[model samples]
Target: MKVDSVTEKAVKAVLDKFAESYARRDLKSAMSLIAPDDDVVIYGTGADEKRVGQEAIKTQFERDWAQIEDPGLEYNWISISAAGNVAWVAIDAVLKAKVDGQNLKFQSRITMVLEKRGDRWLIVQGHFSFPDQSQFFD
Candidate 1:
């Protein structure tokens, strides 16, 4: 079935808020977008970096914030689709910041899965990674 307009809007709003919160370094608002359940998972860019549950995710975010200064994120949605209570979003984003007294820029691809609980949608899973340059030549 095609995704209804309302569901699409709700999902987009959640994603937008998440991006905005992250760019602003508002840890609380960023955490609010994620589900509180212990099953929620986040796979980050670093090797072997996987965070399970809210507390783990929060700690990871705190570490990230501590390492960067003036962080900014620009997201371009590749696609968003919803079926009933579940939705997934794919996006390409550029993250800019200062890390360890040096400028850092990462072009990343991100995928997020969200589930609707009542009227609110919360991220249940998120994966973030830089595109592998090897794939371009294959």
Candidate 2:
């Protein structure tokens, strides 16, 4: 289904808030936006990491956040589309930080499917992967 401008804006709010939470490392606030039964998946060149449930997701994020210093994200682009009870959000962002005193940066493209539960939208599935710069912005 074609997503209206207002719906797009609302979805963008969620994405922006998520990015803000990452930049601030506010684990509690960040997880609050996610669905309770969210299935978070992270895939790159290495083994795929999958976490279920909000508690586990929060723990994983907190651990990961602890390892990085000066976390910031540059959201290159994001598109939100709706289909039935689910909202598909595609995002490209650069996660920048210093890991173990070494400058670390990577461009990641993330796709999240959020299912609407009553009046709130909760994430059902998440896919995150590191991609090349050329594959990012364009």
Candidate 3:
């Protein structure tokens, strides 16, 4: 299948929904966008934050979000590409939050892979990480 405007739009909508869900910390909506398979994987910024299933992902989100206060995301850039029934989105943004009574901000990059299942696109894999400053500083 060739990529088309409709497919691109639908896939982009999924990314928008994911961002909305994150803003609200809506687990149900977030889970809805994830593929219902044990193979689903999501990697967070933390070294130990690799979650390899829907349940584990949910747990990690809950744990991570609990400490954040007034969470917000500022998007500096985003790109979406789709081919056939698969889409991949790349995002660059700054995440701001008040964790432990201290303000925290970091620039992070996110990449999400989605697959069209029947009529809806669901995330199969995702990764969120901060840029490694070693190369620039060294």
Candidate 4:
């Protein structure tokens, strides 16, 4: 489906904010971008969990981030399409994290869905995959 330039730009702006938020570990800023009743669905080999509502996500991440150090995300926005009120962002990125003495890195490809609720866009769903241990994006 072809989207007008305006719709495409709008989607891009939201996606940019999403990436920057994770990079900064600014959960408050990220949560502000999401809709109040947003739902997030994540699909991966080790972590398969569906997070519903913005508050649930906020609570979970607040706790999760508290346990980590220098948690940063780098996302390459591959594609974003919008039809009416719903939009999807396809991304490939690397997540670098540290848990106490252990350091970890993972390559991730994810699709995030956002919905326009009133005057703002909210992240409603996300499906993520890790394609092999080798770096796929670089």
Measured over all alpha carbons after superposition, the RMSD of each candidate to the real structure, in angstroms, is 1.7, 3.2, 2.3, 3.4
Per-residue CA lDDT of candidate 3, range 1-138, in tens?
445788777886887787778878888998999999999999999989999999999998798789798676777887888777788888998888888889888999999899999999999999999998776853
Off by over 4 Å in 2: 38-48, 132-138
Q: How would you encode candidate 2's per-residue C-alpha lDDT over 1-138 as one tens digit per residue?
A: 788776677677777887799889998778867877544543322353566777767766777678789888789988789977778988888888889898888888888887777866766677777865465453
Name the 10 consecutive residues with the lowest summed lDDT in model 1: 70-79
Q: Model 1, range 24-49, lDDT digits (tens) per residue? A: 88999999999999999999888867
Q: Candidate 4 clashing pairs?
A: 35-122
State which candidate, 1 or 3, has the greater lDDT: 1
lDDT of 4 at 20: 78
Clashing pairs in 3: none
| Predicted model with the maximum lDDT | 1
Candidate 4, residues 25-137, lDDT tens digits: the string is 88888887766654454343346344667777776567657767777767765677778988887888787779886888778888888888876777777666678766557
Deviation in Å, model 1, residue 17 alpha carbon? 0.9
Where's the lowest-lDDT run of ten residues in candidate 2?
39-48
Model 4 TM-score, 2 decimals: 0.76
lDDT at residue 131 of model 4 (Cα atoms): 82
Give me the displacement of residue 96 in model 2, in angstroms.
Answer: 1.1
lDDT for model 1 comes to 0.88
Q: Could you arrange the candidates by TM-score from highest to lowest?
A: 1, 3, 2, 4
In model 4, the number of clashes is 1
* Model 3 RMSD in angstroms: 2.3
Q: Best-fitting candidate, measured by TM-score?
A: 1
Worst 10 residues of 4 by lDDT: 41-50
Indicate whether candidate 1 or candidate 3 has the larger TM-score: 1
